[model samples]
Target chain A: MLEIATPFVKKAGEAYLLVLQRSSEFETYTPAVNSARELLVKMDPQAVPYEKGQLGIEYHRVDWMGLSL
Target chain B: MKIILGILLVLGVSCSSTNQKVESTATTDETEIQAPAEPLKKRKTKKQKSAVVTPPQEESEPLAEEKREDPYLGVKEAIKNANWQGLEGEAQKILEQNNQNIIALNALGMAHFYQGRPLAAKYFLNKALSINPNSSDVKNNLAYVTKKEGRSRQAIILWRQVATAGGSSSKIAYENLINEFTIAKDYKKVVGAADSLGSQNVTSVATLNSLALAAIVKSEFDEAEKLLNQALEKENNNEALLINMAILQLDFKKNLDQGRRYLDRISFLGVQSNRRDIVTRLEAVAQSLTNQGEVK
Candidate 1:
């Protein structure tokens, strides 16, 4: 399952959205991440994309994904 | 010598006739004067009766005039013209005749209020209210005095009563009540009062903004938006309405992009120093969120 969260911040009377995407496999996550980026860009062409580490969130890889097959 | 004697005799006869004519004319003049004096003495007794009777009649004529024309008319006109000194004088004249005249009392109170004498205004207005407890004009004036004196709670109650009285002055009374409630930060009462005035009837931008603020505090986002929209329709570029809309979008609806659009509009419209600071801070937060991305 892929989980996506967008948190909003206010600065100088403007609101900005921060998008985060998480999944078990990088290959499986890529589509969801790209879709979310496309949606944010559609909403605001100037919206910048960033990783979870940039916002101080730890990134963890799922060990079970590599063990399967 | 004979001719000179005849001429002297003729002259002496002419002088004697002229003297007799002068004496007769003086006697006729004295008789005419005496004749009028006797009648004047006789009429003097009748004149005394009229002198006594005319005083009471003359006294009541002005009192009757006072009753018919309204003694306070001059005072009212003076107040309308912003002639404060003239208003005071006219009101004092009415009060001198009847101490309990409510119109005079109200006029005096208003004159004092305009002159920045709140205490005196309150005293006169209170007295006027005492004379006629149901007089909305007196009550409204007293409420203004109380408001000026910073007794906002009491002023609110009096204004509410005046509004409830329902007369020519009710609309003004309701407006005053809404204003006082807003200033006192009694948002609940402000909402109730504004609602009582009816949404269609609420034309004042300040009242609408107060109602919107009250709705926001209660978390009634839809109502707040509707009221803000109504006010914006009247004043399209109202800075206060724009700011409130931005807050509603960002804080309540969680729509960052929508909120940013509102902020942009506010910047384009221009803001005061204090509001500019607030907008700058909000924009900084938005930019930080944009840079940091979404937190998981």
Candidate 2:
């Protein structure tokens, strides 16, 4: 099911950036979140990493149409 | 254009089948674009008499020629050329003549959908659905809109209906369900849906394999084994199934030799290099399990 991907947000210095998963579920959210956790902890010192499973992201699948008249 | 036609031709054949037997569509982790695969002429719409525009009496001789040439040729060509705006204009023109034209309604819904307007897309799709409740095309498209609107649970219910109803686009709907569940990491719901689809024989090898993986994640080893065996019966050469079986045998079944047998069957030749690093990693894990011998 290479239909869609998971999403995550990361902190780049003072600003936070959102990374939306446009394709492929294989890329996953854990790695991205893990990196973000590292950056967050540097700033807060008490920030925690996301545990394996449910990343709290919701996704919408792509639908295609043609002149299906 | 050739590729779209060739794909449409193939999907046209698959759509005609009750099982929605698209062997390639059921493939696990191929990372290839799928579904949109069912777009274009795969829609088996009935010709509406009122959709035809009438010609004046003096020009009636060429009416047959005009009809044969297709009044909706612009709409069809716009769709073929991937011109959503053109399709939107043509569909609006058709609807201006006959408000009951399902094709125009569908095209309008699709055009709006492509243009990133889910609300508008829902409007036309619902209109089409109101005209015919049984249309898998409209229902499936509506399901996409509902999902896009962030109503995934509702979308699942709709997809389940389309999948079990057994139609041309049932396979695509079913695959969409698998995709949603996988992304959500909702393995429990996936197993539930797979069981329901399995009872109807509408589920595919990839889905069963996915269900098996889900079962494994849930620590439902027995259910995982059952699903893996079911999938293996259909496609013995499938790497996903074999790898899953190997994991089950070695880690859970405590049968390293059986695991090795399943691993031996995998060649990695069929694995897509662009996105199948997981499969490659699994190969290493299987090798490590075999090398380590029996372990608790």
Candidate 3:
């Protein structure tokens, strides 16, 4: 399996060059990758800049009114 | 068990590059070559291939040939003459007759685009797009407007769509792809786009330099050297080229004197210097490497 090297824009004003090491080539077609915002909370604007793998962490239900059953 | 941890990110700040989210995949890029980016812009197995690229400007000469029988002559002439104001009235008049007219909608969008009115440009172009979703012309124009409006990822989708479709304006779309992806530091896409173009000489100096940088990132040192040399032939004084060429040599442990000389040329640029934050940092890194006898 062939692995390709690619870089990504990390910050404003410059292309932050992230050189990921090669592992195994992905067999399936790459997904329609989401934008940074799209990958995170869609409705919640205040909760941005989340750490990697933060989405997997489950959280208790907390509404804007702050009442739990 | 797989442990792939060699991710060397030379992260630096840059204001010249835009805030664009780049997708890291060759989903739309179909290859005609045996290996991906083995050597950029050489073999061409098909004309169907298209890569992401850049936009156009006013006074477009090819767009000038007055369609004598065409009704939108006023708008066409206005664009040909860079007269955005002149086209606005004519475009609006055509829209008044039939709001869905593609020519009129495109004209209005082009006028707004050249006038630095992205919101208005997007409004008209989106209308035109809704009428003929397959129209590459409108999509390409919309991509430019979207990019300018700071919706770069949206622009990428449009550019990628228009580019892969391969129409009259596909060249422009491909150019935008190379430019945007390069700035976003999405090197694979840049290579993919450049490969699709399949031309050796027409590429600009800046583009060649970016291609070289991409090659360097891929650890294709020989290819990077060739690209950097080709760029230097076009514009030796170009600051980006100088810095990249310097990095290509210094970081890779090539000729010490030449790399140092390249960096020294940047100092000569002085007040009229390339003030890009990334570049300054790259220079500093190279300089420090040499100082510490890190580069042999």
Candidate 4:
């Protein structure tokens, strides 16, 4: 199967970069950790629930109004 | 618009079962498969709803005007006219007329989401869910708003639920979820989801590549290698798949020889025009491998 074009990834990466650039509290650590956790879950769904919850918390920690509420 | 109305009128009559039975029995069993062709022409029905307003529920006055019309057609016209400004009001009116109407609520929520009001969209979508908790449209709309609000986890959850539940939008929801997971860098989930979809279409080699990448990222080298071998069994000389497999070897496995072989496969594909930067990155990887060997 043909993988998505490189330009698509680049464009998405650029958007991600812009989000980082605009934030005063730009923390690459959080996004990276969150991304890593998400990747882990995708790789193996039956992993620890706490681990998934931890990642979910990290992903939403930066939200001004919170992710769900 | 007039043509669309004419088509709908023709469809309304042609859907008559008596005519269908007569035509079918007259044609014998050999032509039964082609009978649906007549209804296909009526697919482009006209929408009577206003440009900016959401459609009303069946009991509402707006529904009286547009109930005969196709919901998708109304949505298209609303979008085409750039009347997003009035869609919420229209949707609200429809809801007021038929409180239990799932379709009106879905349209309202979708309009609100398109108009860039996720919070409002969420409200209407939640209302839609209340009406029909299993509604695929509401779930999809809710997921969309959640994603826009940067709540990708919630979106992923909802999309997965919709995909599993099975609905008209199930495939679309699944595709979007894959994209969302990709953006979130939830590679593990992407791999798992791709695997689920892969079984549905075994001919698609990309699914194997996705699974391989996830395994590589998670440091499951054996699994990644196994999946790559499986993909190659189905396809030979697939440049992207080869490059992906090679990148995994070089980055995670530190197997320079294997990686080089994969890159060589990419070169044979002869599509260098778009892969210039990727090729450059691969060269750096090759150099690093070479340096490590020299140091050894």
Q: Which candidate is the best by lDDT?
A: 1
Q: Mind listing the fnat for each candidate?
A: 0.00, 0.09, 0.00, 0.00
lDDT of 3 by residue, B1-296 (tens): 12333222222223223223222224334343345665444433232134332223233434554445456767667766768898788889888989888878887877787788878888888898799888888888777776666677777788778779986577667767666655554455666877775436445665666556556656787888897788779777766677666666666645667777876887777423324553565566667777777644
Model 4 per-residue lDDT tens digits across residues A1-69: 137676765555555544433331221224755554445444444542222220011111111011111
- The per-prediction CA RMSD against the true structure, in angstroms, equals 24.1, 25.2, 32.7, 20.6
Encode model 1's per-residue lDDT on B1-296: one tens digit a residue.
Answer: 99999999999999999999999999989877777757775556556656756575578899999867865567656755778888889889988999987777787777787788888888888898788888887777677777666565666677778788888566667767665555443445656776667556767776677667667666787897898899889988878778777777665656678778888998998987856755775677567555655652
Per-residue lDDT of model 2, residues B22-108, tens digit only: 554556324334534654443222122233653443376678788787768888887778798998999999999999887788888
Best to worst by TM-score, what's the order?
3, 1, 2, 4
Expressed between 0 and 1, the share of native interface contacts present in candidate 2 is 0.09
- Which sections of candidate 3 miss by over 4 Å? A1-69, B1-81, B87-101, B199-206, B225-237, B271-296
lDDT of 4 at B23: 76
Top of the candidates by DockQ:
2
Lowest lDDT 10-mer window, candidate 2 chain B? Answer: B42-51
Better-scoring candidate (DockQ), 3 or 4: 4
For every prediction, compared with the true complex, DockQ reads 0.01, 0.06, 0.01, 0.03
Per-residue lDDT over B25-85 for candidate 4, one digit per residue giving the tens place of the 0 to 100 score: 8787555556557564343222233334434433486566675664345444554565675
Could you give the candidate ranking by lDDT, starting with the highest? 1, 2, 4, 3
Stretches of candidate 1 above 4 Å error?
A: A1-69, B1-104, B160-174, B218-223, B229-239, B253-277, B284-296
DockQ for the candidate 3 complex?
0.01
Query: Which whole-number lDDT from 0 to 100 does residue B237 have in model 4?
Result: 75
